[model samples]
Target: MKLWKRAAAAIKDQKSLLAVGFSRRASYRNTDLEAAIIKATSHDDSSVDYSNAQRVYKWIKASPLNLKTLVHALSSRVNHTRSWIVALKSLMLLHGVISCKVPSVVGEIRRLPFDLSDFSDGHSSLSRTWGFNIFVRAYFAFLNSYSSFTADQISRTRANLRSDKVDSVKQQLDRIQKLQSLLDLILQIRPIADNMKRALILEAMDCIVLESINIYGRICSGIIKILPAAGKTDAARSLKIVNKATSQGEDLAMYFEFCKGFGVSNARDTPQFVTIPMAEVEAMEKMVKSVEKDEQKQEEEVVEKAIVLLEKPRLQTIITDKWQTFEDDEYCFSEKAIQEYHQDPLPLVVSNQPVCYTMPDLITF
Candidate 1:
């Protein structure tokens, strides 16, 4: 039989011996059985031996034996133990089996029968108590798992780095630097109270790193995209606008008009004018001239109609009532003199004519 198969069979058959107090009449002596178990769990360098150790460790962990018996067995054979794998396996099994009961309690609370208000009521006090206990257990379990996973990842990473042959020294150093930077950023963000904000920041970091990697890879592969010659193109365009402006008389006139409207003086000779191509200036001038000609034609037509109307000759109306007359002879006297005569308590003198009774005399009664 293979050494691995033999080791596995030995471990399986000796299970009763490894657990509670073994019967003295069992197949193998207690001392020999304990020796075989120690040898099986210990690292032997050979592939077959290591495989057997892994298999036995797995079987022992999955077994339904009580933890107290296992711990006792481990402690009794601690001196004979050649590896910590057995202890680790035992602890993992104990944790896994015992921890399974805690989550069901948590699920019960999570799916609680009563509403949130029931927490303060006396009648639902027992449910609240059990809910709180379960929540505490679940919270601690989560914290333990989180910490354990972090430690395991860190340990494995360190082991990989120490192996030395798997990667170059420079690559290892770069990875360490990146990890340090990540740790620093994590510390900086630790004080944030919002989970979503923290997650967004982490996601942004991931995206930035991935994009940078892609850009670097593209550069290394010599696949850079061509960009327009910025300096040459810009300079050429600017020169074109300036040359066009100097060539167009109408553009110069428009530019000066704009400057004047904006209160800009030409004393300093500063180029405050925006330039356009000569063709564009000519197009604009043509548009303006067309509009002006249309307006002038409309104005001339209106004046011609007015002249025709004047030539048609219409009769002017005259007022029959002398009080309603608007001729200048009605107001020949000085206004001040008339006002004074009216204010005097005497009648006006007429040149040898009989006085006629005015409407005011009849109204005096």
Candidate 2:
């Protein structure tokens, strides 16, 4: 009664005192507010009087303690807690200017569900986003928790994001962009001892098999045939990249002539090429034989299917046996066969270059 009387009197007579009280005790821990809240709400709106209860609630909300206290008091006293939370939520819905402590603000945002697509403002600016402040907090929360912003750099960026209320929606978006860029940079900096075997294998294939001297490698059928270039080696480097390796080359000098193009390797999505054993290619040939003729013809068809699936070398040397090497155009498909294979009638270029695979449509039958 005394607190209520004091509040009622303060609202009616001393508005400045109530405002000062709210200003000091809203965010800080305070002793007077709990007793005031209890006193202010103990009676019906008319009984304790509207002015007092209204003033007290306003003070509490202005203190920004309403949400913080509502969250802290949500426990076994479910009904009372629910009323407080419901009232706080109503206040949140009513006001956008109000701000609370970061942890409490984070907890409040955690209670709701949001779709990422809902926040696209479609404004031309890079910094603009819809659902501005709430999404900023939520996206930061989402990335840190799900994306595991666990790296030192990411953790630090997240800390910075939480510590400040970015001035505008655009600023919030920029902060997120900054954080992601930092995260990407961190990912690219591999520790000195850590090994990335996939990348290393791709580098090898890019260097050895795909660009290997006097050889053309295809992974689908897993063939690496050694071509006879003047500088081509009979003794190859690592053959771990292919299933079958044959010292065979198609002399395109008779079919076409040498030419040059861009020397840079800009190809993407290079699958891991490793040296598979001859046993695998043998097993493949045997598997072809194992398939009945009704299903697919013999080993030659199997090799052909492999070449087809591999989708390389418009002309490939189809060796029936391991000893059948390319002596001349007898084992090779004619230019007519090569020309008919391509649906697009673009004239093909045959080059006597060091690495023959660069000729996009070179084939051997």
Candidate 3:
């Protein structure tokens, strides 16, 4: 038979049987016809049946498959009954069918019993589904482990500091250091995965850093307040060591840089630097003052030299005056007065004839 003829006949048969509400007579006849088709198709031993089975599996996997459609397909041998459909059903059950706790048509399917051996074949779609599910489970398990470890560390630190006897500065510093180390460990793991899980791990690490910084700041403040009054040099030294160690840690260094860049300096009454016992601060101030004095002296010397230079005499150019004689027919002043005039108020009138001069020749020429 032609392929379209077979498909048309199958559709017609299915429609007629479905119209009858799958009555006992029609169901038995359809089941026998389905069995005959299965036997005949199997004789050829082609992969068409397997491919059809995969198509049915994909459809069922993509959405909630109804029992009626599954039963119809299984009875018609359009898809497999024992291998494909039954195995897919079992895999769905293993994926937490019940606690998915869906309260709808899907809930009925979840309530069905499933056998493990139905999907025992490794090549089955059932096994592939289960493998993906297992991966998800393992990923979550790792997340839980990281979260629990961080929470436990925080709880222990809180417990340690709760007792008055245990509030020693050394112990507090140790706790902060351990917390910093744990944060580093978390950050190291963030780059290992490429998915939502990695994103979640990074987010968790950020929270840990924030929480740890808050705790460390509080402890350091407490230590600072008590250490100065206790007058214990060893306690102060330990605090310094803690500060240095924290600065060396990568995350702590980043935090410090961030705070230094953006945090405002609070106005506290400047604590007496005298009590700090390190003379470096005082020496630095003294050195700055000395440098200022030297600079002022140099400026004063420059000004004094500039003033002396300003007081010195500046040279002036002198020009000798020459007298010229003119016979003034129309005269306003006497010739004696004109000759005795050391400076001329105006030029004397001279003859109007033009005069020219030529260069002198050399004696050899």
RMSD of 2: 31.0
Cα RMSD for predicted model 3: 26.6
Q: What's each prediction's TM-score? A: 0.17, 0.18, 0.24
Report the lDDT of model 2 for residue 323: 63
TM-score preference between candidates 1 and 3, better one: 3
Model 1 whole-model lDDT (C-alpha atoms): 0.36
Q: Model 2, 255-315: lDDT tens per residue? A: 1111111121322333233443566445444444444443555677789989889885677
Better of 1 and 2 by TM-score: 2
Prediction 1 TM-score vs. true: 0.17
**Cα error, candidate 3, residue 126 (Å):** 22
Flag regions of model 1 displaced more than 4 Å: 1-80, 103-365
Cα misplacement distance, residue 60 of candidate 1 (Å): 16
Candidate lDDT scores, in order, read 0.36, 0.33, 0.39
**Who wins the TM-score comparison?**
3
Ordered from best to worst TM-score, the candidate numbers read: 3, 2, 1
Q: Report how far off residue 76 is in candidate 2 (Å).
A: 6.5
| Candidate 2 lDDT score at position 83 | 27
Residue 192's C-alpha lDDT in candidate 2?
Answer: 21
